[model samples]
Target: MIEPMADPKLSHQLDDKTDDIKKAADVVAAHLKKLEQTQKDAKDDIGSAQWRLKESQIYNITKHFRQIMNQYNEECVAHRDRCKKAIKREFEISGIRRTDDEIEDMIENGFPGTFSFS
Candidate 1:
């Protein structure tokens, strides 16, 4: 029954890598927050289109809103992917296993956004 000795160098390297990943994740999370807010605002604008009196005005407003919404959606997806990659990199570096759903939940719930692990 021999116990393995801990490697101090490896521990320090893992800590450094974890810090780097956490920093990257924080950046991505901030972008995700902005994208999420923009997406919500776009949805709100589109939902308010019911006040239009003229059909042409409604069509134009709807079209504009749709375009804005589409752009936000695209940006949101991009930010989400960025966060996903960061999390994946962290997992690889730290050897922490997390499911896709867990990673998504973290971003959605603003877990890594503030870089507040507590």
Candidate 2:
């Protein structure tokens, strides 16, 4: 006696289901790859933002220090002028008749008994 063959309709249905499952798996894999790339891009963007923030902070700090230095220099200049005026007044009161240019030169170049290393 000959053995009976399997049903063709059942085999076709199984093949169709297998193909559907494979297509679904492929879609899932593609989605996962896209998600991974998106994550990497987000990390890179965060790093770039951090660097920009750091640079801005550095620039602001430098600008602040520069302003402080400029203010200090202005105060020093004002003090120096006051000292020069006081010295000129003292000289005049002591019967010393020196010209404006001479007094300025003496103040900048150091007086005879003044301690100057520059």
Q: How many residue pairs clash in each candidate?
A: 0, 0
TM-score of 1: 0.44
- Misplaced by over 4 Å in model 2 are 1-47, 112-118
**Candidate 2 residue pairs in backbone clash:** none
Q: Give candidate 1 regions above 4 Å deviation.
A: 1-54, 113-118
Alpha-carbon RMSD, each predicted model? 15.3, 40.2
Tens-digit lDDT string for candidate 1 (69-108): 5675576567568767776666667666888998788655
Scored by Cα lDDT, where does model 1 land? 0.55
**Per-residue error at 108 for model 2, in Å?**
1.9
TM-scores for candidates 1 onward, in order: 0.44, 0.49
Model 2 earns a TM-score of: 0.49
Q: What is the clash count of model 2? A: 0
